[model samples]
Target: MKKAITKRLATIILAFMILTLCLNYVLQVHNARNDMYLDAKNKFWQINQILKQNEKETEQVKEDLKANCLIRAKAAAYILQYRPEITEDQEEMEKIARLLQVDEFHLFDKEGTLYAGSEPKYFGLNFTSGEQMQFFLPMLKDRELELCQDITPNTAEQKLMQYAAVWREDGEGIVQIGLEPDRVLESMKKNELSYIFSLVTADSGTTIYAIDPGTYQILGCTDGELAGKSITDVGVDPGTKMNQGFSARVNGEDSYCVFTDGDSVILGITESNRGLYKDVNSNCLLTAVYLVLISIIMIVSISKYMDYYVVRGISSVNQRLEKITKGNLDTKVEVETTPEFKELSGRINLMVDSLLDTTNKLTKILEAARVPIGVYEYNKDMKRVMATGRVADILMLTEEEARELLLDHVLFEKKLEDIRLHPVTGGKDVYRLPGEREHFIRMNTFSNANSILGIIIDVTEDMVEKQHIEKERDIDLLTGLYSRRAFYRKMEELFKAPEELGHAVILMADADNLKKVNDDYGHENGDRYLQGIAVILRSCKAEKQVLARISGDEFVVFLYQCRDREVLSAHIRELLLTMKGSTVELSNSKEIPVRFSVGCAYYPEDGRDYRELLSLSDHNMYQSKRNRER
Candidate 1:
């Protein structure tokens, strides 16, 4: 009996020692993982700050380039306007072009005739003739103003140049200068800003890549092999998960990648997380070894002093602890042999019951949550663990089916693939359920070494509401056309760059007798007249044509990509003929025919912006109205 008591006491001592060592090891691991997360977060924050500063500097450089170009053009125009003799002499014009360091130089007469230029081939060209006429004629019509054109090919110079021309203060002619884009860009010296990338030091395992957002091409990188490759080619998605940083595998190693967008480019910094936990893990392993040696010493010393009187009860309690560790929390220690052992057994059982209750409550709360929450760990085999809730409903599966789908990784492979490429937080993606009901789900994700935790919320209603608001905000309620504000917005979108706009025309039209119609037939009748005109305009509009009622009596139509001016005139003529034949009868049975005065301006010939085109067309419309009055 004494020998049995000794053996049981030895077993209990060994088990306690092992449990103490294991708990210590687990605490060390948790601390190490936390430090790693902190290190990664700090690195990302630092890198993103540097990227934002570089972007701001780049934007400032762009603004300075434009400002400096304008200054140079104004100075050149001021000099040339005072000296008309240079326009008459080709030698003088060539000398002036060289002196100003301009790619091309020209002078126009008050009639917009190219009186003299460095290129003799273009000397007789009229500013009001052909496709290029609109750009220069607007200065004449607007009464002697300065103007600048975007980059375009100057066949005379055989290079791309940006043209800036100004009217002579004396109104004699216009002084025009052309700048080589390359020269202007060189003068700005944006390339010097590349040194900013070098300031971010990346160790052996880390990398920093500068990318051109416009082209998604790598401009500079710590790795020479990554240079000239697109962001995608280097395993980075330029279009995916912008602004927010993410974690993914790069070059077969886990890395944290942070992205910062500049005015013209994107900066990506990739950092490896291996070194962050290295020291902590090493120390934990050493400490665990030390604890094992100490535990062995304690086991040997305690066995000799333990007596047979307490052995049976302690063994029974130890057995229950072993069962609890193996997930048998309901098992209680049967320790009624001694009064002391009975109290100890009751306390142990109480602690285990409390732990079990807490765990069950937490599980129920997660199950009741409206948002879908999940964890995915990918190591050897991909495993997904999801909280019980709307996750199954969202996936259009029963709870059991959802678990099966996750285990198979079939239904969610695409989503998982994207997440593997780039882990997203508050990122938007659309998914179709089993019933084909599409939903917009937003995910806020947290990532560790090889695992991701996500909270998904359905935002379909929010998205629909925003779109409806935008539609209402941009449309004119009364005329069923775009509002004045929307007209300008659409024009900005359609005519983003000057080169993209080919043969565009703006037509400004006004009701000729709107005031007379209103006074004679009352305000309600005038509204009917206006609605009738809107119907006609809507009927005449083709694809991509934007028509808007900008004022009470004024309407504007932007005819996009209509190369032939005759086509525009024919359309207007047909509309007039239709209006001439049709009449609106008011409540008094009084019939009135609609008449309109229209003036048109061509793009890249008249002006580039809406203000410039509208001013010219409006002037012409008033002039036409005056002619009709005569």
Candidate 2:
């Protein structure tokens, strides 16, 4: 009997040892996974923080550029108004140039002939042939007071920067202020790595400037070499390297690379995955070994006692749990054993009862939740509608209709694709539904490799409000005409449209002596004079045209299908003559004569499109005014 008992006891001890080892391994694996997940979360948070900081710095830089440009534009306007003769006066030009803090200030005649600048040699040099000149022509034609151009000068010595505002004084020719590119970059530098800086053409991704001042690395080709090269044309190898993980070692150490394609910027950070994994493995191994040792000692010491008091009791409790798991929650464990076993069985039965009650309550709550909730299985070939709750009532669809809508295989498949294609975060559209309102159907997609979850929210009021806000922004509040920004938007749209059979005409008009009228009469009178000219321009338009008050006293009209320049010029001249005849009665009942200068340029004939036409017309208008003064 003693020998038989020993063999049975040995078998029990071996079983306990195996169970303890398995439990230790499971616990170690669970802890290791949790640690890795936490690490990843922390790393992602760090990246997000960096991105936010960079964005703030970039915004500050943009604000500074705007402020600087405003100051320069105002200065240029002052010089143009007070110093027309100063265009030829080198001393005056130098004084104003110093005050403006620019390398050079150039005055272009209405014909785009360089009339005067700090550099006397450039005078009379025509810029009719260059693409850069063509771009600025439209702004001048429109008499855009706050226009800015990012252009490289024809002179090789001057680097590229923004030229803000092409101003034309009543008696003076058009004046342009050149701002330094380095100054713009310097304004944006919040910290060492604040700028994701590159200089590219407005419409193309050609890297004219790509330097990291922090690293002193000419990311573009050597200075003056890659001045006009596209980002793709630069000879950086596109091959995938081994250390190209989320965080990788470059040049034998871990570092992040900020890449800019002159337009878009990307930042990549790498970490030592090998070192991370090694540390994790070591920790897990140590933890497992320690736990296993402790478990083995406990199992050996308590095997007989546990078998008598705990294991058999646990088995009985598990059998009762199995009944609960099988949907027999009414079945409870019998308490006919030792006090410890009895207590455990009682607790397990009580826990099961509580869980059942909670589950029953939850089911009732979900059933009462009237908003329709659904789950669907989506695959490449088909979309199978799986489950839905009562939220379909808001859809105004009957249960049957709702079911039919949900089950429509073709519709479901298309909707699923739409959802997959349109994300809800980061400039993505969202649809939402409010109480008993318009049925807002917003489609957005959520996805992983194998599955996707698309959520729809009905956004009825939001869409309406957004539309209203946009309309308000596009319309000018002062004169009830199209704002300058709106004009630019329309121009962009027109330029993007398919080429028509005939040419388009853009006419730029400026109110003559409006500032002098304001100074002599009052601002209210000045406003009336501007409104008067706007009325005349609006009256002259018969075709589908955009009449916009771009600035203080400047207006632009887009004329479509107009071929006769003489007819347009005659009409403009007639309007100007009428304006010269018309007078604004001020608060003191003093009549002030209203006069305006008009310039016209045709598409493809004068220049290609809006920019070129505007430039040509502006140049011509200035020339006309200059001759009139002479």
Candidate 3:
């Protein structure tokens, strides 16, 4: 009976081992294939995202160019309207040229003849030969307000022709203002690659402009030689025929050429797919090795027990042991064995049973103990926050002092506002807990019909460490004020607030002749001068205002709740005078007075918002410097 039992146990162990090996092999193969497929899919998605981002950037560049063109056109129109007498004057032409930053500025008569221009050669000349003339004559006849046409003056000279109608006080004949194409396209081409750009005439199948420098072997054309060929004539599949604006390969190995115009297509061919399998293969090998090691460990552990313990034990005892392993603690081993072995096995079984019962009890206790949890309440639309925990807390507080203290905290409203999105549960928030300085406060959000849950955890240490790192990041080592990056970030946040109703006054002040100061004072004194200026600006600003030393000698102050333009101007002048009184003592024991150029701009009056206001303020500051030089 013992031998038969031993044979039966051995056969069972052998069969189990074989089954485990087979299952492990199948699982590993499946996992490897799945990983490879997922890796490929991720790579494909990454490429798609990159392409989308590039496309977005390109569109933005185009929009910027269009906006710039409109501005230049409007400026030209303004010059002609306000200064009609200077329309035929050379000095006035130079002024307009300088103001517009154009190479050439021209005034055309009703008869398509140039009346006055920056170029002496164009004076008293007719512009009726090139493609620009073809686009210009029709506009003059139709009395068009503005027109942008592309023209190739010669085989080597291609220009963008911008012309806007200039109506005089009487509104009789059109005075056309023209700018060179190079001035507009120059800056754009410097940043955006022109090789991927193609200009095609909309009505005709004519390639007006093509910048592809490489030979198109697939289309049987050489560089600079594919200008006149029809897009369909090339090997590229017609996007119009496919009824899609853009198309890419299914394998994502290649991107399809884009037909931006009816007449031409722009092909942006990317690099070849090499080393594509490297990451997938590496991951597969590593995972396979890990699985094999784990399987070996599991097999050895199972084999050891089967040979030395379970096989030698009686059938009833072995059955009880299996039940115990499966978490059945009620079943007790009945067969008697040697005293030492029996004691050891019996103790282990009892201990496991006790642990199981204790685990269940603890789980129930934890479930019951969970309390004081709150969730965000949203309106019917679910996008806007109707009420939150912080709001509820404020309402609950009968005393105004208690509410005021909590409201004064930096993250008070922001934390609650963030919870409105129910982002904490989705791994969005990192906060610090009260009274637990070392611990961090973490919250996870859960949502149902009426409210959203914020599962809060203590995360104090994390918040403190993060604040320390942020302070280190924002503070400049040299001047000890906020760095340029910090200033920009703060400005972005300030301007982004929709509730900011007050007129924002921005003052840009720069130390006069900083380079000369640096050269004469050996940089050490220059450093002192910069620090002195930073201190003056910081001291001059009110408590609510933001002061930042943006550059080596430049300081930016954002006056949040200033009275009016005149009041803000007076404040700036006063600050400048105050700065003038302050002095920096150099190494030579000589006092150097601070000199600065101040320029200010107001929101909604000087410009629309922060970006435009900053630009206008910067322009005004430079203008002030120029005036001082004069």
Candidate 4:
């Protein structure tokens, strides 16, 4: 092509300006719409990251549920050791099942025979009955043993259950509890296709959809209106290779679309292309007229002013538009020499802003909805910490501390080590700040020689709730006594004191007629019998005496630091005298006397261990009962 020389320099400049605007507008329209599909791909990647995180979270939640199962098993064992009335009471055990949030609750005797449970049909089942039952055989032998099973089908009903078992601390029997995995099932729901769609963040006009690979029907869609519609119904060609970007008539409008490779789910992204180029198309006629007018005016004004001011402003505006078309949207047409040029610059800037504001909007959405964690980088080469968003908040650092931590290499290394464990709770790989208030943090790091990247998560709410729940679990609600767990904890702390610890005594008591009271009256009246004894013992309780109902018909007392054996005996005699006339008020308004057999074994005198002393006292009480019967 031959270059045409303009008779006037103004016409030559006018032609160049016209050519620049046309090319700028064309590139802006083509590239801006293509970006929508790219965004879809990135959004899909983000969704995959979220699902992967959910998988890890699901495993953690399952582990927590298992620990909960163990705690519940221990609780059941505690009740059986202390509440004898429910030993063979199927109705009572069923009530306990509800209270413990369990589907099945069972108790096994020393011989590994299941004598009782919430379900009466399972009574008389033995450890040798099935593999599921046999799992507890070790618990029968090792009284300190604890065991839990994975999600598996139960022996009889074949229902999927998670079971945990613990041997009674008193060496009586095994207590077990089962759950149906409701929490785990709920967590598994996050893996669904519909759930993945919910997590996706996409462009304003873009519609993300999951289609059945066989039927090509929409399984799930971000655009609610397109749900249940087939690809053909949306004006998309079923035979088209959708991974490549193409123009199509989607829902009566021209759109740019890209789809993933087909699988059980085929994901596709579609965004209207018409509106993206509407500004360029609508301004074409105006631009043509402006070009003609500019030629006429430039031919008239041929002075140095026109060459310097007019040409310079036009060139500057063209440069900005070039940058804008190349995706530098922040570039503004700021030429301001002449009124006409200034007004033109302002309108062009506004046009660019209107066309690319979706980028700005999407950026804002991501920044605002970001969650508790933030990406943190440990630049090993620089020995500096680099973080974005709320990493400082997750790390519980102030602006000053965060700056210092980033600046000081030794501090950064120490901070890394500090976060590797909980200081107060001794939990590995958990970060904790224990002070007037406690903060829990969790972070996982991946690294190369150059840097370490971490995802810092705040887990204070979970840790705090666990601590609170444990406090609530340490006491028996019915008797207002220390729960079996609390009782043992207290006893252990005392026993752990120095060896110079003075003489103590262990007293074991059994409700001699508790079973008869339940049979003659009701379990309600039987509870009253236990309560009556509890009140009597509490009234006789002196300083340093730890009392707890160890099982349905059993109670234990720890008398700490007695002055002498005579004093301990006198205290026991006083307790027996106090309980002599204690009575339970029955539902019939009848008052019945509470009769119980009591025995005592001195600490260091009877045996060295609490369990051994308990066994000796228990034998002595039963022996006295046998002698009295004779």
| TM-score, candidate number 3 | 0.37
lDDT string, candidate 3, 1-630, tens digits = 555655665666566656765676567545544543454334334434444565666556555544555566567767677677776578777887788875556666667676776666766655465554555566456654555543234211344444444433344444444445554454344323232332211111112222232332223122345555544344444434332223333123432322221122233221112222334445556656665676566556655655655446666676777766553444676444567657767786677667556435544554476533323333222233322233333223345633442333323346455434433232346532233234344455566775444444434445567779989899988778788899889888877873573656888888887788799988998988888887787776454578878877788888776555666676677787888688889999998887888788887687767778778888889899999999
What lDDT would each prediction earn against the true structure? 0.68, 0.59, 0.56, 0.77
Give the range of the ten consecutive residues with the poorest summed lDDT in model 1.
374-383
Q: Model 1, residue 151: what's the lDDT?
A: 63
Predictions: Cα RMSD each: 21.8, 21.8, 20.4, 21.6
Segments of candidate 3 deviating more than 4 angstroms? 1-33, 73-100, 110-112, 118-540, 543-630
Residues 172-269, model 4: lDDT tens digits: 77888999998788888897767878877765667888888889999888887777888899999978977787889888888888888543577888
Q: Hey, what RMSD does candidate 4 come out at? A: 21.6
Tell me how candidate 2 scores on lDDT.
0.59
Superior by lDDT: candidate 3 or candidate 4? 4
List, residue by residue over 493-544, the lDDT tens digit for candidate 1: 8877766666677888898677888898888888878777877777674455
The residue-by-residue lDDT of candidate 2 on 1-630, one tens digit each, is 545655676677667666766676666555544554454344434444555676676666666765676677677768668656666678787788788788667777767677777767666655465665555666545664456665456543445666665557563456666666675465445333322222211111111234333442344322345434432243332243312323334334432222322222222222233433445556656766776676567556655554465456677677877766554455789755678777777787778668456435544565687333333334433333332343344334577866665554566555345435534343346543333554344554567675555544444456667767878888777677899889899888877762651456677888899888889877988888888777777776446678888888778877765556665565666666766668767778877676788778877677766888888888877887888879
TM-score between model 4 and native: 0.42
Worst 10 residues of 3 by lDDT: 199-208
**Number of clashes in model 1?**
3
Clash count for each candidate, listed in order shown: 3, 21, 13, 9
| CA lDDT for candidate 3 | 0.56
Candidate 1 vs candidate 4, TM-score winner:
4
